[model samples]
Target: MDTAENRLNPPSQLLLALEVRGILELQAFFAAYPLLRYAPRGDGHPVLVLPGLGASDISTRPLRTYLKAQGYAAHGWKLGPNHGPRDGVEAGIDSRLADLAGRYGRKVSLIGWSLGGVFAREAARRAPELVRQVITLGSPFANEPKASNAWRLYEILSGRKVDDWPGREAMKLPPPVPSTAIYTRTDGIVAWQGCREQYSPTTQNIEVEGSHSGLGHNPAALYAIADRLALPEDDWSPFDRSGLRSMLYPDPLRSDTDSEAALRVSLAV
Candidate 1:
């Protein structure tokens, strides 16, 4: 998904304004929210969480804690703050994926935020056999990688300019396993358009009403994560938003309605 082109960048100023919700995202952790109060328990699988650019595991602690409480063996990437795929960082992640799968003797699930989402997709692409599924929170891995509001800052922190890498093209499709892209219309870091997954049998796009930063803590998002992880290993299905949950989550498959064409244009870009 990392490419040299800047053909479709989002309104940088708008992204900046939307980023302010990052503060509210932090507040969710301190609030006495009723969301996710009874999210279904998981099958006690091992889940690996990755933070966004410039953030470390500390940023993911709240999400990881929730996952743990839901009976998942959640682990944060502790190899220091995310600064992009610097020299050994990518290798380390691959090794980590391999080790986790081998040790647990089961496929691993990965959840990543922003740039970390990009990392999660690539890892699955390389080793689908070891990966059960991937869930990305506001990751811009489908289209223009340099389109993020933080691309410039990513360059500064990563010590490398934005550029294409191996398997970037393959990212246009779902990784060799079940893939879910959890995005919002108001994402301030990267264009929400670029975060949508192409309509595919094994890929899905889940829409939530929260800032990109708050996605990890958003009640709707947490419940969706629980719903996804609860799926039987061999009977995967698209998100079910038939009843009251429909009010919480927009119809992700509502492409035949008014929002269809615009949504298509956005993801197609």
Candidate 2:
């Protein structure tokens, strides 16, 4: 008895459907400028990026390359495409974080896209000592896991049930480390309101301009990530999207004031 209203489908938006074109723009932007020249150099900490559902490391190559150019040892989640909690995935993540931290003698920062962000948050919670910080792009980790337009497809692809994954409570719990969520109100895959973090000193959300799928390579998002990563581990501060940065990155909290009911629903779990 599944009807359109009850089925999980991507959010309907013409612009969101066209977000794939962002790749061309990204490539051109990188080619036109030595982007790394303006970026603050990192402290050579380890960074791990997880891919979205149905995407592999190849989709994250551009972001990883940019991070590497910024002086961080960025690595991809090499366990292939994310198809939910598949065999060896959780263990692989745990081992990967352990290996990177042990190898570099420093905690690793996690950057995850879409479903990958869900993985990042969980990993951070599981091993906060090994995680320096966590960032998520367009991940719908709250307000009922199945509320996302991508949920049914996720269930089909992963052969796992979203409802059975210990839903709402897990999504609402903040990771032990500093956490950031970068999402766009125009996201075509999930309800933007569901992607926000509970506002806190150690956690925040950034609203960007792009499609749900384009967040990985969105220049503004990259700048924000670099800005966050550049901070000293001991001197962590909330993202400063101030002045010029403010012009580019809108405050998600300010933008979502009209949707406080949804925010409350997200936190109820």
Candidate 3:
């Protein structure tokens, strides 16, 4: 549940215990692989996948593979592990985005998980013309710097205080391109509230059910990603959750308020 007060703090430690469920989500992904064929296919546009904190391209291989099978030319960040925008990271992603767009003669779509999503959003903002769209998985972009359990680890790896990072305020605004934020309230790392995007014509917030770490491979998340990627270059629209789809992807607008009310009741009890 998300509330202004709760948003001020990281998710409860009890939630971290749920991260181990990521293994189960992985198994589910493989089990559902056959069904993934029914997912929407893309137009062979270039897509770049970025990994999360402490993760290398290796972590995004499964996702990239799926995207490739869908006919998109998916590429990894290829910048080693994501250690929170070290000296060359910002420049590296910029160069990669420019090179891919230039080589393919098309704007590149970006899919990033966790900290990688943070980078993806920033990259899109830095060069909207080079970006087709941005999709983020469990990335804490719209909340306070300390609203994540990994802030300490981020400080250690990036050698910068969580609050002192550059562009902390500007990053909250949606990029100029179509953007999707896929998140889970059951997330074991960052607060789910921070993982949302502000309402906009080109931006959306999608809620799935899973651990924070498994979003990259979570079947629901994967399906949403595929659907978003399949949209024609200029035909972008909000994700449709009519009929049966509503059962899978909750209405974040309603659910957020409902969950907050539920939390208030629970606290009062």
Q: Pick the candidate with the highest TM-score.
A: 3
Query: What TM-score against the true fold does each predicted structure earn?
Result: 0.87, 0.87, 0.93
Winner on lDDT (1 vs 2): 2
RMSD for all candidates, in order, please.
Answer: 5.1, 6.5, 3.6
lDDT of 3 by residue, 1-269 (tens): 65675656777776687688788989999999889869999899999999999999998988998889888999998999899978999999999999999999999999999999999999999999999999999999887888888999999999988888788879999999999999998777898888999899999999997889899999999999999999999989999988999998888887355343444476479
Q: Write the per-residue lDDT of candidate 1 for residues 1-269, one digit (tens) a residue.
A: 33446366663564457567777866765573445757778888888898998999998888888888888888887779999888988898888888888888888899999888889988898888888889999888875756677888888887776764556677667788898899887676777777888877888889987687788887778888888887777777898877988897887666524333444476479
Cα displacement (Å) at residue 3, model 3: 12
**Which candidate achieves the best lDDT against the true structure?**
3
Per-residue error (Å), model 2, residue 182: 0.7
The list of candidate 3 runs beyond 4 A from truth reads: 1-7, 255-269
The residue pairs that clash in candidate 2, if any, are none
